[model samples]
Target: MGIKIIKRQGQTFKDKLFIPAIMGGMKTTLGHFTKNLKDVSNLTTIQYPEEQPTDVATNPRYRGVHRLTKWEDESEKCVACYMCATACPAECIFIDAEERFDGKAEKRPKEFKIDLLECVYCGYCVEACPCDAIRMDTGILSFTGSSREEFVVDKKYLMNNERAKDLSND
Candidate 1:
């Protein structure tokens, strides 16, 4: 599709007054203020590290850590297409491919690594996989690492990122 430019209109008397805008902003703010005033549970912050996360994300659509899914026979689902690396805006995924000995046309990833430091957690990589190999529904919200090296996780680690059992139930 070609770019279309719309004509701009100059500010009118109502726009210049700012009272209506201010009132509208206040209405939105007061709505949230009253909502939070009724519900105090949302304001409680869990002290992380010292206090382990009691509740992980409950949303099924929640995207947290990445996981490399497997086939019915426990074979890797990734075909080493590199679409994930190509789709990644942050360029955090690195994969090395080798021909599969099982007489498959698609090659397997000899080595796969993802740098959490560079990852934006946008989930584009999961979307780019044609085999439905990668997913971000692990429910492991809080990932930690003391060093940059620890943040750069490999295929083995990604393969182990199973969804929490409690989260898997619902």
Candidate 2:
């Protein structure tokens, strides 16, 4: 005649309400389907080739292309400084220094090349340049080539033509 307090274990609240939950999910799914079908023209995806989305580089500080600057005299402002080469993590930059005809032996890179295929574009070279002769601000986004050799950019190609004027101005 004593009431036994047995713990209720079988068929919890979730199991008891399964039918209602399933009906609710089905209703929401059907609602979404009807809404999508009603306004198919309102879809946000753009047709890539026909309508290219403008590349919006939101960050001004983003590192993209590398530019070699010169002093106002238009001479190579590089002074053959090896800081960039030493700082490069990938060891992509190679520089060959030479003594100028002038009695003062200013370091001048006879051959400077950067293997774009190996470069990480980390802007480490730009930061390491003591003369402010290098910068990653060319605004050039992409470089394309069929082979590895084509991707290797030489100093003549990377050096800014206007850099000499900039050097002279300095």
Candidate 3:
């Protein structure tokens, strides 16, 4: 079989000079500038921490903060399976499982921590969970901390997050 070769057209004077492309770009820029000048609201500047953008839309499927789900007894649903920690691509999840002494559950997480700096928010940990113990639907887009140690979220904080309570209202 013979290969079919396609012919290409040569550039015109306007294309060679790039005058039309430059004019089109300038027109678009001038239009946006004039529109923004006419209506200040069209500008994308936001005074963060004091004033948030009202027109901004958040994604429903956005994975933000992580929270541990609770059982009916108000105890953590996580059985210390370490599936979340194992599936974490960033290795941000850490779990230390220990046998329960009170006979309430077979095993419990002695220490569960997640480094926010290292977490990629990929939601793989939520998918890898067998008991649906973890969820990333807190709707918290910001996680501010003064120090590196403050970014590390332990099991206690995960279980009693204020954002978790806010999620129930929605």
Candidate 4:
């Protein structure tokens, strides 16, 4: 039975001083600064509030904001199964189920609320929906509100993709 104790190399004065590391970082910063100075017009910076991107919604990979989709008959596509809420990692989604008053025995969410501040935008809610009811394709990013209460969106807001007036760019 033997215990192996690995010998470690002690830091020299130069290594402890960290001059090389600092110089490397400064070199990178100065390199970028000189490059920008040479051709400032070629910068790809977007003037966000004034110049909004045109392809946020059209881009397949862009997941902006949540929206509740609808069936062909203009009815909500949700079946009130609670699968989305169950799958949500953030636990931001809340659903209150209510039986349909119509002859059909279908159920619907009386209160479907998603706290935008709490949501991680992981797209798990959309994938977990069996009825294809929810999606994050509105391209309606940059929302603003006076308080946190205004951030918790309801079913009606999600369905119509509303809250445009709350947009920060507005």
Candidate 5:
């Protein structure tokens, strides 16, 4: 049996004129514009700062602010392996490793810092961590700072931030 091919007819004079397509596009545009203009609530865009989306902190998979996890003893889980720092493509992560005096581990981060301004939120740091020390599940979507220094978060801030503590309940 031979396959039958049906060819589409050429464009009519109306289609060739392009008036119908233009009118259709304009109709769609005007419909949305008028609908949104009449009732602003009809729009799906969330008014940030004043009106936060209800789904902000509800999703576990949502990546937001970065945080450092702690052990049951309240010690930092980061062994200062520098995996996160190395994996960070933005070079936002900075870590100063120091030998542990208590002899519990070979090294620990004396100073760990992340520049939120430079971070691209790629979640590479979290994936690179073998100890589950780093996480981006703080559910913090808004970060405002008056100065550059305010955006640079240190180890102390990451470990003690309220957003970081919220993950424990999950």
Candidate 6:
């Protein structure tokens, strides 16, 4: 008679273990599915504008909006140092430095324009400010423009925002 090898028919230890494990995994997934459908945990969403989250204020070092700070005389805090421009990964900050009238010791930006369209909100400019003139605290997360030209914000526009004025609270 030819040698006959019988194939393993019954469930082996690995097979038995794997089947239960799969069933357990499926059960866990189904549990999650049912829980998700109910959503009693209140962990999935935010109330947005009405119930503004406390995460930003809680995190003191958190960077939010971009602000072009001003001096006591209401002049720009920016010395036209160009550090922000250099630090930008998106290359969005553009400055035109000019000596103040009557010849001040420091140069000032005659034309400080930031292309918001190109800005990645990386907060590099805020960090690069040596004079603490520029900050990310206006809390402006969204901006819209009718045209590309409108998106290129000038110094006046950045410093003149209503939200920025609220920062002073005077």
Per-model TM-score, in order, reads 0.69, 0.62, 0.78, 0.83, 0.75, 0.66
lDDT of 5: 0.85
13-93, model 3: which lDDT tens digit per residue? 767888888999999999988988899975667678577433321455668889998877788888998899999999999
Q: Which stretches of candidate 3 lie over 4 Å from their true place?
A: 1-19, 41-46, 52-58, 101-104, 163-170
Count of backbone collisions within predicted model 4? 0
Least well predicted 10-residue stretch by lDDT in candidate 3: 52-61
Assess the local accuracy of residue 129 in candidate 2 as a C-alpha lDDT between 0 and 100: 90
What lDDT does model 6 reach? Answer: 0.76
Our model 6 lands, by Cα RMSD against the true structure, at 8.7
Q: Per-residue lDDT tens digits of candidate 6, residues 18-114?
A: 8877999999999988888898675657777656655554354555556687766778878899999999999999999998763433789999988
Error of 3 at 57 (Å): 8.7
lDDT of 2 by residue, 35-120 (tens): 99999987778675566343422245656656677655656677787999999999999999987765333668788888988899
Misplaced by over 4 Å in model 6 are 1-30, 39-58, 102-105, 162-170
Colliding residue pairs in candidate 6:
none
Model 3: lDDT of residue 69:
85
lDDT of 4 by residue, 1-170 (tens): 69999876547888788888899999999999999999989887779877876656556766778988766666677879999999999999999988876533389888999999999999999899987789877778577899999999999889898423423331
Pick the winner on lDDT between candidates 3 and 6: 3
Q: Using TM-score as the measure, which candidate wins?
A: 4
- What are the lDDT figures for the candidates, one per model? 0.85, 0.73, 0.83, 0.83, 0.85, 0.76
**Candidate 2: minimum summed lDDT over ten consecutive residues — where?**
161-170
Q: What C-alpha RMSD separates each model from the true structure? A: 6.5, 9.2, 3.3, 5.4, 4.0, 8.7
C-alpha positional error of residue 112 in candidate 2 after TM-score superposition, expressed in Å: 0.7
Ranking by TM-score: 4, 3, 5, 1, 6, 2
CA error at residue 57 for candidate 1, angstroms: 2.1
What is the clash count for each candidate, in the order shown? 0, 10, 0, 0, 0, 0
Clashes of 3: 0
Model 6 lDDT, residue 98, Cα: 91
